[model samples]
Target: MTGPGRGTTADTPVVVAARRTPIGTAGGALRAVTVDALAAPVLAALAGTLGGPVDDVLLGNVFGPGGNPARVAALAAGLGDDVPGMTVDRQCASGLAAILTAAAGIRAGDGAGYLAGGAESPSTTPTRTWADGTVYTRAPFAPTGDPDPDMGPAADDVAVRAGLSRRRLDAFAARSHARAVDAQRSGRFDDELVPVGAVLTDERPRDRFTPERLARFRPAFTPGGVHTAANSCGVNDGAAAVALVPEWRRRELGVPGLALVSAATRGCPPADLGLGAVPALAALRDRPRSPDAVEFTEAFAGQALACLDAAGIDGHRVSPDGGAIALGHPWGASGAVLVVRLFHRLVVQGRGETGIAALSSGGGLGVATSWRVVR
Candidate 1:
């Protein structure tokens, strides 16, 4: 990857605005909200802030009624008929992938402005069945003969391989919840939230999970695994979007934002999908100068700890305002959620000058993006 701050200022891609709907657990508060419905308000909020026509709208989504949920959301948001939309589905990395795709376009000088992020309403995802009427929960992540364990089992394997103990994983999970609860109590999330319907705050993140309490739960994925339901992220519904433009446009608007430094996506063994983020972050070559802020999607306590350890990142330096483990992981939207969090910390709050957002995805894929605060 190119060194940070290597590109011409005029050609750099900048994120001007970011927003997200309150995350609700699957079949909970957001159960009635469809994928398009969840995204429309977020898109509208971003468009309203930018006060201009969007050249394109890109959204990441896992499941919906199909036929391009991004297009449906754009139309629903009242973006002009001329505006086009694209949907990305890289599993958990979809949101970040969509944003990076838009950034690539801006760097290529293809468009003046774009709206990109991810949205998901797992509660309303349509059930699928084969022609013979056999039901399937999800699609295959690897070809036959390749190891493609479910995320829970894969996370367990990751912890076992990394020699991470259950106590350590439980502590991490409890910390995530505690931090999120504190942030919520302090109104740290108020600025970035876009209320959908009557939901004003995240529906997860209770202060009840101490490490001692979490230890009471039995193994969830394997017979003697370190993973447990309490330590893993919950399936949820939410949407997050960001307004992107070239540095020239941002300069004209005089809006503070995040300037894209570098982004990378890498592949790893399907069986060890949780470690996917390690190589992706390594590819950025941002060593020697650590990012002042880092946000990694915490899909599971064990998986997150394992990845951070392997990547040589200090676990305590990640997600100071908590993470997916506490906020809830709306599969398709989690990666984008990480970016949204970074925007809040680095640009909105002036907490840091440089930040990194990274996440592991199904199918052995990982996505990472580095950003610098632009005032």
Candidate 2:
């Protein structure tokens, strides 16, 4: 991997705008919102901030309709038929992967503007049927001949390996709710959020959550496991999108933006997949120095704790405005949600000049990307 400073150039990807729909738990307010409907408004909102036409539109999705959501969203967003679009599905990493993929194109001098993000509607997730009319809930996340442990159990294994205790996990989950509540009360999320009907705020954060209360829930994965439903991410539906442009275009537009510094993805054993981000970030030879903050997708309290420990980063440095545990993890959109959070912290709030967003996917894969705020 090219060391830190690898892509700091005129042609690097620059983020001009970022926005997201209010996150809703599965079967909640957003359940009625279709995948394309969820994404189209976000795409339009992003384009409204751009000075000119967007060259391409890319969306990441997991359990929505099979048709090209990006194309559908682009057209529904009124971007016209001339704009090309595509959808990406890398499980939980789809959103961030889509952004990084676009960044690669920008670095290659592909186009002046690109809109990339992720959208998911687990509430509306479809059931599959075979020719014999038997319905199936899911496809295997791992290749044949590989052990495909359930994600919660895999996270339990990671917690055991990382020596995280139940108390710590509960504490982490509690903190997430507290931080999210504080961010909400402070209105820190207003600018980044595009109102979705009557639900202007995320629907998952519990103002009454407490570690003591969290300790009462039984383990959801395995007997004697450290994880509980209270600490793991809830099934959610949401969408997030970002506008990317080359550094030259950003300057010409006179907009403050974040520079896409570096990005990488790594793989590990399927059973230990939640630890993927650790190796992925460790493999990065050139991460920005003295990162002011980090945002890792909160798939589970145990896995997030383990990754934070392995990366030698303080757990406090992550998700100051709350995380998936408190906010909701719309799988396909969680990765881009991390980037959107980073943009708010690094660019909007000016808390730091540089930040990194990372996540581990279901199929034994980890993805990480770094950005530097450039005004």
Candidate 3:
């Protein structure tokens, strides 16, 4: 499915390296770690995997503590001072945007190869002081319109417009948790999730997830709304990194079975829009028929479903292993996280159909990438 001169073929794009920080709920140990420390371990792991220095490091970050994120992460990860880097900011889609940028660079022969990935600590968010003296972090960036509204209001409006019932929404959320529990039990995520050692103040490192405890928290965005704290994604801390190597150079480093497939980027109207995933889906599903399956990060269960419906695909075809609702959505990291999850699913499922990963960002933007299973 890969075209010639596209830096890919029918072979798997070699994943030279892969690593991630343990995902913690907001205000967790990762909050204790600096952004540089937050991103360094994963990059270091990637460098060690490739056996040498890489050409560039692409990072996806929504809220950095302060200072230049890409440079800080690169330096903290032990890259040379001269090594180039770029920080991507496309809202939630920033991670996938970063991946596309790095992939394009390698495909264009800009450098020997490159690293593309994302990191986020939504826990340590940057707050803004409004004239009313209300401190907020994510409100200013959520959807807005004539009356103006935050993401929650926009989501409520989306639900109303889509005719999504509370019953249906609850079912969707329940399904996500069930699937995640199953995937974890079946070892589907073991291949990707990295466990990090940490100290909680003066205490020892302990597991962060406890289903019983997680079930106790109430809704975050809309307290009385259908999206509960248990169901809705929260501020989280985690980092993921991947290496992209051109097909021709696969043998030089003894890495094989990897390639950059096809990708598409597009813009949509900015508003409390009803459908954000249409343009990107239309572009990637350009070949013959609808995509075999749609893999989207669960920014919100209903909103994610809206995109699938807009694309004219069954919602069931999306996120078979659960989504942000269960795995947690860390804003900028969700885009690349979707790609990484899709890649793993394609590799393990032994299916031949192409997969599409699409995400909607703030400011009416949608981006998608297509990956053909390398057999």
Candidate 4:
């Protein structure tokens, strides 16, 4: 487990070039596309720019294909026959875990060289069936009954325990929309997105939001569910890919946005697993000059606040442009999506230097990752 700051006898890993599809709501443009299909163009874009096959392909898919999705996406995107793939599931933290694994592969001098990024999709998501004739929903937010309480109900539970009020949730949703609008208007996302050819039957690239648009949606979970469409992470479709430089060749192909800071992934108690980020707080609290230095991108408004409060993060610095609440969530790719968004905000704009993407997931589990932009 040799990692950053261990005097680990090598340079920390860095991102060479990274790009993602503009996220869109399900049944939208990419709705008909396969989870791997959405990712193909993104992989092609990165490869075309980088001029070769990547070191590997790592995917973060929670509910789609059950067998070797990472490898499938790798082959689908023209990554070449030799490149291997690893599919990881960390609830929502899957994408960052993939990124870190790729980074570690490079730092380990294992000759892994470069890695491609990925996340989940639900529109064409893989569905499961039982002999009893019951169907299981696989879309990002597909609501399937659970013998155990689920993330939505769990959010209600967290709300009751944390005493989060309806007013706060509404306000947070509003701010998320406003900030997402700001991000789009200011073109904060221009650099992060790749122009995957127009999704068939679609005209726009990324999901668009506004405070007013969210204000009209009603509650979702319960008859009077505390969570509303605007207040929750929208069911969305998208893909992301980033290249990692091999330690042996970092200097020769030094890309403009190269950066290596630190990252960690942790687990949370299952019963209240949606509250996973609790551990990430202590992991990053003592960071250098990291004061007033906290930023987080989470999948849900209720849990993001609850987890941050649970982790004792400084509230002011969290997802300045709003998160899933505004940007929408594509499940499997969520962890990586949040970190890339944070990295771009920090590296591209002049946002906080240190940021954390932490959140809980469906099962009694959660994870977090840390990142610092290359200066």
Model 4: how far residue 344 lies from native, Å: 2.0
Clash counts for all predictions: 0, 2, 7, 4
What is the per-residue lDDT of model 1 for residues 1-375, given as tens digits with 9 covering 90 to 100? 222233437878899899999999999999999999999999998996554669899999987668999999999999979999999999999999999999989889889789999999989888889889999788899999888899999999889889999999899989999999998999989999999989999999989899999999999989999999899999999999899988777777877879888888999999887888989988975442678898999999989998899888899888898999899999888888988899988889888888889999998899988888776
List, residue by residue over 218-295, the lDDT tens digit for candidate 3.
545664554555545666777777776655455556542324456677776556542456687778634325555556
TM-score of each model, paired residue for residue: 0.97, 0.96, 0.82, 0.84
Off by over 4 Å in 2: 1-7, 130-134
List the pairs of residues colliding in candidate 1: none
lDDT (Cα atoms) of all candidates against the true structure: 0.89, 0.88, 0.65, 0.64
The stretch of ten residues in a row with the least summed lDDT in candidate 2 is 1-10
Worst 10 residues of 4 by lDDT: 1-10
Report the number of the highest-lDDT candidate.
1
Clash count for candidate 1 is 0
- Mind sharing the TM-score for model 2? 0.96
Tell how far residue 351 is off in model 1, in angstroms: 0.9
- Regions of model 1 farther than 4 Å from truth: 1-8
**Model 4's lDDT to the true fold?**
0.64
Give lDDT for model 1: 0.89
